[model samples]
Target: MKTFVKIMLAATIVLVAGLWFSNSFKALNNQADALEQPTEVIEQPIIEKTKIEPVKKTPFSETIVVETAIKFEAPLYWAVNDYGLIDGYSSTEELIEKYYLEFTEEQLARLFTEDFFYNEADGVHVTASASPNLIQTDRDFTITELNENQYQVSQVLYTLDDGETAYIFVDYIYDEVNNNWNIAMINYQY
Candidate 1:
């Protein structure tokens, strides 16, 4: 009786495992069959295509215009006293203080060559001189390229007090060592 009971218990466990495996296998087979089946194709409505015309090609010409204005960075004038005399000072600081000029010594120095200012028998004087108030109303500038590093700018100036018209030419030369352009010379013609 004991042997028979043990055999029955083993058989019941085997039967339950077999049923579980059979159900799992059947579910996997059903999924594979569904994947192998072809998908449904829905019909789409067709519309007529419109014809596109070819664009006509035209000859194109590109024109470029460039305008540049040259500016004088420093004042090109000599300091004068109340008595209408060219005032000479011992140093730039003294000249600025006496004339109430806006330029610093360094800025004034940059406007000319290294030896622009020198002491004479009477007093210190500059090589180039012009008054800003004398510049004409038109202020038209004619720029000429002298060389690769030199440029000459010519303009007409008018004096209000004397009613004088003069043509002023300023030459600028590029300083290679300093990598800047400095006023090399200035000339005037009536």
Candidate 2:
């Protein structure tokens, strides 16, 4: 949506600028015709009256250019809250629940996967044992907000007992085509 809005804004500005330049050129041409004489090119008076000396214009002046209003892509901040953890995915069941809602047709087209356990959700729960039980688990993941229409995620894995840990950045793509969020892809160990 942000991209769409930006493209629209650019197109509108270009159209307006084109119209303005066209009108200005037409007016300038009309004025030139009315003058009925070649335009005069006058050199600046280089002699300062008080100094009474002709000083050559210095060519050392520098210029500064600034863009005041144009905006680039907004910063990619995580949609997650504090502590760098998604507060909800504490167990296998919870993870499954979160994953299922996230894979609907309203959400599937945007998602990609590398896991061996690929399954579909059709508004009903599939076989219970087939899905990973939300066993006692702890994982780390990064959630980044890529605009109103996109998000990227990285996964972090942790052990259950000894506090040993490993890191993974699972890339996720978010889409808004079905008026909802969907996964685009996931590289679990990336």
Candidate 3:
């Protein structure tokens, strides 16, 4: 009789636990439904507006695209090869690259810009008994390098094609937006 009573008690406990779990699950379901179905937000409206303007458009055929070919983007330059090196070996190549990257054609013109510095040391003399003509000397200079601090160049006064050459130096200032080197002053002609 005692064994029967113990079995009955165990069965009752199991049934009660199952019922409680089912009712708890139902209560959770009720909460989810109540949260999902909102009690407000009755209506919304639809409206439209359009505005137009006129402008001239150029034809695609006539459009020209000019892209600057920066062989090396500086700092960590030549990291990803955008411009292929033809033979991959250049000694004077660096100087040539500097000219394109550091100076514009317009900036190059400024080197030849004529304005007397008035300060005797900075001005030029055309005729001197012991010296070569400064005008002819300048005409001989060919652009070799454009740098953030200086312009490295060559001056060949005697021979146009094959002459004794001297490096012409121009002082420079660096431009940030253009990332360019500009002539600040022609400090030395060496």
Candidate 4:
């Protein structure tokens, strides 16, 4: 009777386990089937389209003409080359003639030494062709006397097209006969 009871208990446990495994397998199969089936996609409702009007362009002939008066003060010092482009005043004479600098011919002659135009090995040659690009028409210069006969004139000069500014130094010598100063040397450092 004990052996029969043990066999019946073991059979009942096996039967319960089999039923559990079968139920789990059935659940997985159902999930797999659900995944394999085609999904139904719900269509989104379409929005109503609004009509857009094209922009009308003004005709050249019928366009409104609005004239604005713009007052521009002419540069105190200005010159033009043969080609009509804005050019720099080349000489001390030109500077005076264009009202850029206030100096007389006798004063200029005394101040600008022949060696003033000399190009040192390290200094840039301030020639007529190179003059236009060296300094802007609107720059102001500061002149300070160093000694009895020597003066230092300095200015922040700018390049015409490039808009580059440089510190320019001009050493001048006072001539008693002419009663004015002359440029002894000139150089610029950027």
Best by TM-score: 1
What lDDT does model 1 reach? 0.51
Cα lDDT of model 2 by residue, 1-190, tens digit: 9999999999999999999999999999999897997778999889766856554432211110001000000001211433223333443244345554443222322231112122333221222223221111233334566665455554455444766654443222333433434434433331
Better of 1 and 4 by TM-score: 1
> Model 4: residues >4 Å from true position, as ranges?
1-137, 159-165
Task: Point out where model 1 deviates above 4 Å.
Answer: 1-90, 93-138, 159-165
Worst 10 residues of 3 by lDDT: 60-69
lDDT of 1 by residue, 1-190 (tens): 9999999999999999999999999999999999999978898979779888654432111110001111232223353533223355665445444432221223443443233444444554555534332223245667677877677767776555678777877665655544445545567788
Q: What is the TM-score of each candidate against the true structure?
A: 0.32, 0.25, 0.22, 0.29
Residue pairs with colliding backbones in model 1 are none
Task: Tell me model 4's lDDT, rounded to 2 decimals.
Answer: 0.46
Best first by lDDT, ranked: 1, 4, 3, 2
Which of candidates 1 and 4 reaches a greater lDDT?
A: 1
Q: Pick the candidate with the highest lDDT.
A: 1
Q: Once model 4 is optimally superposed onto the true structure by TM-score, how far is the C-alpha of residue 26 displaced, in angstroms?
A: 99
lDDT of each: 0.51, 0.38, 0.39, 0.46
Residue 70, model 4, lDDT: 8
Query: Which digits, one per residue and each the tens of the lDDT, describe model 4 over residues 25-121?
Result: 9999999999999999999999999989654432211011110000000221233433322344444344334432222233433343232332333
